[model samples]
Target: MKNKIGILALLLLSQVCFSQLLTRKLIHGQVVNDSINVENVVVFNANSKTGTVTSSQGFFSINVRENDTLVFSGLQFKSKKYVYSDIKGIDLKIKLEIFTHQLSEVVVSNKNNIKPIQGSQSIVDKKYFDDEKSSSKNRTMMQVGGVENPMDFVRMYKDVFKILKKKYPKKTDFTTQTDFTEIVMKKIGYSFFTNKLKLNDDAIKLFLVYCENESKARMFSKSTTEFELMDFLIVKNMEFKKITAINK
Candidate 1:
């Protein structure tokens, strides 16, 4: 009985050690490539079943463990994954590559094996071909599209999006936050003041007004982690409440 109890305690200790394999890494991730900051990019980890989307500034943070697979998915770009072991650090930047699809046209000549449907009559699906954009995953189209001229296929695939832009108009207005002060304010959201800091409405209004003064705004920004930022706010929470007699 004494031996069994000792073994059980050892097993329990081992279980605890195994559970502590990963430290909750404070990650500041940016979704971008060499040129653009890709907002709305989905950052997911299948192993942990956890995920987050990039903010308008293309920023995100989540606790991830070692060996976790971080999948970066978005509508405009190809979905890519990076193992957490490969991304274990403060400088977490994910660069995304654009996706293009390839397709081929096969015209069957009744007599011979194949030829370009005789003269300039064109294929049967004229309108369809004009509007059709193939997907990269369409193996059937790729098989039919021919065993391929990759460069031509990529060029033609790109033209599909251009045609789409003409057919439908979308707002492309993009502006980055140039003012460092404004960038700081956006990082610490309004909810943090009410919920985390527990500041009253009147005090919150005054603090927001105070942030515009430059010195106070220095505490918040993209570089600051959420926990560290919250700590700073907690200090401010005490200071501001005291100065206004609200703490009394």
Candidate 2:
């Protein structure tokens, strides 16, 4: 009976200790002027792995301790972070402002009666334009060697920041989608493409056009490995042949 009593007492003591572990405080936040409780507001603790989403009533419960930073993100507003100590209460009333994007208007004219491309008002395939091409900054971040051209290095740095911003929260994406396609073309010069794929000048240009149209052009960056990029291009070459054959 004594042994049983002692074991029971120890177990009860352990339970009490476990329950007394880090104090849990409720952090309440509201989106001001939001008639409906904004649903799916992401609450993330940048300091730790603690995260949660707000409810339809614009209410969320998260287990947080003191000194934990909470970053709130939503589609309708700019992402904001609140440090637990910065605000002394469990409840936080937040106002989310809509983010605006300024874009130049594009007018499309069909003088050549080209097929209208999907996703944009362009009468012709938008791929010919450098900015219209899909680009990936992941390749830029993966670059290992040094860049001799100062301008290229600057562009690469810009791309890296754009990548980091897009990766977190994923609200935006970064593309080296300016006139940089020329830089890419110069990097993967005719000699490089000819030696790798054994293609003539005309064929290579056509291949480039195909890559742009297919949105596969971004894979060829200075940081891309020769073997991998070549493999991708070769496969795409075969697919391009099949496509051209069908069109003819």
Candidate 3:
């Protein structure tokens, strides 16, 4: 009987521990403007793991365990984060505070001085350009490893521009784009497995999401413009740009 009692206590303790274990989720809530809900607001945990976006009804949810912190954000509203303990259940009524970022003196100066470089418009990296052409590195990257110039690189960029221009006609400006004429180039590094690349899809997706959000903010938002998207792809590929010195 004593052994049976001990076993029961142990089982009960195990159940209690299980119940207390931390879990993550999507917490749902709404942002109302004149009694109408807004959608696509971001809600994420401090660790950036648990996250979700508001629906058309202005409701969002992210799963989180006890003591986790959640951030609520959107393009027009100031971001706010709160601890799980501060709110109970998924339903929440949040009042968004309007935010207008005042540029610091340094920022103002930099903005004025830093003319938009052609490639700086988007986050295009070399890999994205390569992947668009089936992940084959061409002259700039392949040439360094004693490999033949892969023509696919040019094809990839060409195809990317073609598609982007069709998708976003007004914003795309591939005509003024500079072709990467090979100077002295070298491989900074190589990866046998694509996942080994630090700035992979996971990182890029976040940028894409940000771009989407930024586009919706105003009558004319720049983030998701064709020029920007293509630029992002180019910038992403440039990570793999073989070190090259042009004899200009």
Which candidate wins on lDDT?
Answer: 1
Q: Which stretches of candidate 2 lie over 4 Å from their true place?
A: 1-22, 33-37, 103-248
Candidate 2 per-residue lDDT over residues 1-248, each given as its tens digit: 99999999999999987774556666566655444347555566666545565566666666566778776666555667676763467677766666679778976786876655576534332334334357534555656677633355665777798898878855322245432245446445567677866677755655554454333566455455556655667786666555334323
TM-score, model 1 to reference = 0.35
Per-residue lDDT for 82-158 in model 1, tens only? 88763357558788887667668765566854556654334532333232455434546536655553355665676
Please report, as a residue range, the 10-residue window in candidate 2 with the lowest summed lDDT.
171-180
Q: What clash count does candidate 3 reach? A: 29
**Would you list the rank order by TM-score, best first?**
3, 1, 2
Q: What residue pairs clash in candidate 2, if any at all?
A: none
Q: Candidate 2 has what TM-score? A: 0.34
Question: Per-residue lDDT for 65 in model 2?
Answer: 67
Measured over all alpha carbons after superposition, the RMSD of each candidate to the real structure, in angstroms, is 22.3, 26.4, 26.3
Assess candidate 3 and give its TM-score to the true structure.
0.38
* Candidate 3 lDDT by residue in tens digits, 1-248: 99999999999999977786644554556775654356656665565443555666776555566688676666556567677753577666777776657766653363544555567524343443346566654545535555444466866887899998898868544333321111001112223113333445433333233333332222222223444434543443343221110100
Q: Model 1: how far is 42 from its true place, Å?
A: 0.7
Minimum summed lDDT over a 10-residue window in model 1 is located at: 172-181
The list of candidate 1 runs beyond 4 A from truth reads 1-19, 101-248
Winner on lDDT between 1 and 3 is 1
